[model samples]
Target: MQQFIVTPEVRFLHVVTEPSLRLAVLEHISAGEQHSDNHAPFFVLETPTWDGEGEWSGRAEELRADYEELRAVLAQDVRGVSLPAIWKAPSGARELTRFCLELSEMLRRLSVSPFDGAVLVLAPVEVREPERWVSELKTLLALEELRKARLMVVEVDGSHSEALAVALAQEALRVDARPDEGQLREDMATMLAGMAAAPAGVTGAQVVGAAGPRGVSPPAKKTQARLSGEQRESLARELKMAPALFDPSFQQALRLKVFAAAHAMREGKSTEAIKGQREARDLCLDAGLNREAVILELVLGGYVLQAKQAPLALEVFCDARKRAEAHELAELAVQAQLSAASTLLMLQRFESAALAYAEAGKLGLVASQPLLAIEGYRMCGQVLARAGNVAEATAAWRKALEVTRSATADERTASSAPEVARQLAALCRKHGLKAQAESLEAQAVALEEPPLRQTQGA
Candidate 1:
């Protein structure tokens, strides 16, 4: 097999039907011929066979064992902390996105660790959605921490090879497996020369601005004349009264009333907004629209929170949460619990806030919303820290990290656990828990990549 020197900047490589190529790459990385840092971790995601079972299963197990052996060898022989290899089957759609997201998050965490080394990702041959996979890979590449991560895609039976090549043309290079010894040597030497010639500080730029991953464009600025306070009040009154005339049968009218109340609040009419929200909530309840009633209650809770009535907000949010749970509205229940937790925090009920946050996180996890769960745990840590319970705070933060790490295969946490660790570390340092602070700081570093420092030597 031909061997090429692996550079830190090499992000993508495509091998054509060469299973041993992964071993060769690992060997080169372990040798540390092109970099000074220790060999990093390896995470392998193999695509499941078409039937989802059969001979490929045993083959996959064998490959996984081989990867484990390779990891052991690197750890022992090369004196590197080669973390365990992660093997995953090719999950379609949501699963694929989750896989990519998890890998990206892992790479990000690895980048900040003491090792500060590269990661190798071995992809499956028959990627279900090549274009989408490539797109996600591009997104991962755009992440700062994952810049040193490399992807190796092995093409089997020429499956989507051409399409994959085109999609990843800018980021990946084709690797020739059957090259002659002379050709292989030349390839390695050329790669080394290219790495040496490459600029150290090459940066990427965003070509287009977007509001979210779905490519939704930002709303255009409104050019209409702004309504005066009196006009707004008049509109609010009209909306509130309009719902009553139709015997409150139109949910849209009630919704409009809620919107008017929001507008009034934004216009600084807090008293009027509170009154409007109460009236709306009562109307929704009277109409037997429990879901709508819960929403209105949440709005009222927000108004109370804005008015600095933390106690009232807590009550309202708690009621909303109960109503949402009774209605089997998981999303609304999670939101209400989070709102109640915030109110508790505002009121300096630290222990209660922590409990509420934990409850919210549990609800989020049960609802399969990993981001919400992560936020909840993160808040729990903050509240504990504020209450002068460093140990408990650290525990909560660790729980958050665990949740992030063990998030469902289809869930995305957006790296919230690392943020929690970072914040907790800062809090620990502030509180003079030197030993704890150091430990947390190291965990934070392992969980997140700090901004790169400019060293004179480099």
Candidate 2:
């Protein structure tokens, strides 16, 4: 005999770039049923139109026909189904209030319960007065009868979907229905070229001249090498000559701007570094270079931190982290998280700083950057210790030491494992972990030993 299992909470998600929002809805429904042990009732409520501009009569008729089709389709596969409701989204505040009252009554009558399983709601895109509509919907969903119902809303991106999703639901999931990678790359390249060409201050020839021979060709692939002093001077000169060429819309421009910013930072010209970074960040956003924008924002945040504006720096770094996560740039996201944690430490928000550092360490491990993870754990320990959390701080540093010791010999050398061990030993000794301190000191000494010289037998 199968026992019925009821899901306790409602779920909300946004299908980004999905015009129909059908796949996401259906997938959730199928998953819900598949996971349950017994048969459960399911309901679906769809909205008439995203924008409340069309004729009410015509839109209602269309919605009715669509609902019938959907109900018939669900009837074939799904059991214990109830008639779906169509929400006539209102335009004005007064109408919206009245509509909410009516909807609340309808939901109460539905008697939705945990055993009733999932209730999928297809929301309209291009909603007018989204704030009011979302507020009303939230009230309706909060009714006791609908409390256990798995309420899911499918919404399109760029229609204030995030704002609506956050207001109406506890969790929001993003489904990226972007075009194929090749096509996306082509589109981005085209857009960037157009933006680069449209700016009036710099001609292509001038840009090419300022960028030197490298600008005439497609931008060079990114390398790990640091620029020489001469190269930095050349980049700074070119950037000064054609300031517009520093826009991130052009790869050459982005490279030049990065070099120029680095040079300014090295030269202690914080204002110039911030200005160039801000301009590059705006250009990256415009060009859909989200990852690049996140990196530039981090750079800008570092400058803000240097200026001793910890609050503003934290805000900027948090924004960068959000952007990086949204764009699925894991490495950059970890970097931003670490920067934000550092700013929190500066502001003496010790608990939050520790949590942020811990989160960054976990994310760094996930992103396969063990060195970053080590640094994060180290910072977490430092912050915790400063907050007088001695035991936890010792634990964090010990974890850092453990991670450092686990690395390969070459990786340990590359990542400065000796320095990490020494730091841990100092912390352990300070906290009265004499045995742990001795162990860490031994590890540090071993790490510091020079590699044996290879000799050919004579």
Candidate 3:
């Protein structure tokens, strides 16, 4: 005999009515779903309280607890939620029309997912407009088809509307923005009183989101590193992956991975650092980032690897070179050549190193990197001198000296000029060009003058 087990479908839901506050709530939920390990069913109903007063009815307690727990976990204090707005009101706040389209879209999404619970909270700052929001909430409550789903209504105290100003705040899911508890209590009192005096059949809890919890308070604030708007937008941009190909949580995981890698690099953990760097590139690519962005990441990875494994660094540089060439990324190609040159020099391959330096110089010149171009010449001189090619070395030094002299008037002297001159002088003496050697020395001395001294001399 076999026993049959039934898994009751669980759906979590939240509705926010405040305009300013809903952005934070939406952000939190989006971030959580994109990052959280839990796979439980949760649906959020987000909107501005159309006017100010709205009747709400639903299975309330369940909604409140689920939201409070979520807020507590995300350490909600750091990131302010964001919402869309089409225009600003006379008071400089967002007008309600912008939220209407978003609200309609959200409702459509919720209807597609069966057994998904939802929460709706309304925060209307315009005290005089409560009746309009009340009407909107009433419309939401009339949908009996979602009878099993939970709902909640949060009314902000009109006095502190500045603090409690939107649907997410109306929902009170997380505590990023809040006022005194007494202020909230007063708002709740006004809401209850207004509901009691409403017309028959269109009255309390009947016109708002399905009633769930009432007079609930938000969690206390906590200390955590919060993300700025740029970070949130960047994270959101990363989260636009195909629903089937990669889990939404990949965005959050990638963020954590980036942080870990940066920390590892700071701690001098080369292996872990390299691992993190690779992970960021993989994640970014998976998220459909452009080739330029990915190459920038690869460049950073190469730098980290070079600090630990010179051989691996060269391999990374080669990979970067191929990718940059294919994508026409001239700057990245130059960076790759520079890295390759350094790696070859590290391996004591003077000829190969000189060729790498030459490649770098060509790329640098193409990319308008004057300083790098000068250094490239100096490196060629060193490698040639080291290879016992005195004539060629002296010529390379002379070219570098020419560039240094030309740049002296531009205030962009290459720091390596003096060293290049010394090397060139040595090469000149070896090749029996002592005058040329002394001429290079004098040029180096004149260019080495402090910027202030240079200005005075000029």
Candidate 4:
């Protein structure tokens, strides 16, 4: 059980448990069911105060800060799960909506089990109406990710309103509980069993799930499966459902625009998506989310590229590279350069692409991202070689070789080292660098050849 789980996102539950024993129950859930010896749970427990004169609704950014901080902790633990070799932490600061969307994306991408994770939030229902308050929390607070990846249990002292429970039927479980640790534990065990049996049915007062039996379960993929288009819209729609009250401010408006743009993209409405993203980017700048604003340039560039506006895409990516550099966002800077390089290639500007990739490689090295550095330099050499720039190609490949040497102990090293050496060796031989070519050939062989197997059967 990883700390992160995916099922229904948020569930409101009130069940019997001793005050003394609630902490223990939380710890149990946080640890997750004992799936394996190496399993780690990524649980976040938040207890927010409600003292300020402003409505919790009004403190959107502050609440976002707390949620994102908890998410950042989860992000670190998420790395322990299986992921691509070159994955990194989610990029820098974002507005509340983008932050929540990113957190949801990261959790969904990284989680291995369904609803095996929990977020235990202990706080008073803040708004005048309990239903409205929870709604705001889900949307405004960006706890919306609770639907697909994990169970969010917001425990309150008083009974929740009937209207609220009814409105969230199937999504929440509100139990009439008293202090009985033993009974609570038994119930939880039963609930967890129900969840494992039918994770798709997450929240109910009776059990986690109670469904008719099915055929033999298929083997789960090592990676999270891609959500279908409908599923993606369902996820996006959750964020787009933020309360109308959230629309007054620039930040919230931008949030809606971004969400709309995203859904449009997923629905294959490119024109609308581009228009919405463009508007959202300007709103980000107006709202003072500078890093996010620059990030949107990257997004707009991608959208433009997809729409077959290669020249405009090149311009946008180039602008993004400059913006990222000015903001000192090294990773985004590398991404911008790489994006521009690819766009340049699409436009048959091979020389410019080579220059861009080389620049990205230099930036990647500066950012301590050896994988990106290796990729950029490798591509630079390839593009240069194809264009018949033998000397420049040799220099780029040699630099890539140096980067691989330093990254030898990295997980990506084995796959990368041999390829870089072999390519460099081929180019070296072509250029008549005989001794260098021979040494590179030996290096490539040493890296690629496997140890001999000892066999008894002849």
* Best prediction by TM-score: 2
- Backbone clash numbers for all candidates listed: 0, 0, 48, 12
Clashes of 2: 0
Model 2 alpha-carbon miss at residue 370, Å: 0.8
TM per model?
Answer: 0.41, 0.43, 0.41, 0.42
Encode model 1's per-residue lDDT on 204-292: one tens digit a residue: 21111111223332243487344455664576577754323333124444544675577667666888889889999988777666777
Please list the C-alpha lDDT of all candidates, in the order they appear: 0.59, 0.58, 0.49, 0.57
How would you encode candidate 4's per-residue C-alpha lDDT over 84-154 as one tens digit per residue? 22223244333334435544544454355332332434333322355654554456333545443333343
Q: Give the clashing residue pairs of candidate 2, or none.
A: none
Question: In model 1, what lDDT does residue 32 have?
Answer: 39
Candidate 3 residue 68 Cα shift, in angstroms, is 72
Candidate rank order under lDDT: 1, 2, 4, 3
List where candidate 4 sits over 4 angstroms from the true fold.
1-256, 411-417, 428-458
Residue-level lDDT of model 3, residues 1-458, one tens digit each, is: 00000111212122323555655654554444332232223433322233221112111211223333343433333443221221221222222332333333333333422213333433332335555555444444445554333333433433232222244243223232444556755554454444333333231352221253334422324763444556656666688633312232444455456655555565567687777778777776665554644465665646565476777778888887777777677777777787788888988888999888877777766766656667777788778877887777777766766665445444343356655665665456556786886676555545544222000000
In candidate 3, stretches whose alpha carbon ends up further than 4 angstroms from where it belongs are: 1-255, 266-268, 287-308, 402-411, 430-432, 453-458
lDDT (Cα, tens digit) per residue for candidate 2, span 1-458: 01112324324554444555555655554455444442333333333343342213222222233334434444454445444554453433333344344434344434443233334444554355656546655664666644544444455544445665666444444454544656744544444444344333344543423332332434344773444556645775776533233433465677556656655665567788778888879877876667678888998999878867789889999999899889789899899999999888888888999999989888888887777787888888878877778789878777776776556666665554555565566676566787886677567645544332111111
Count of clashes in candidate 4: 12
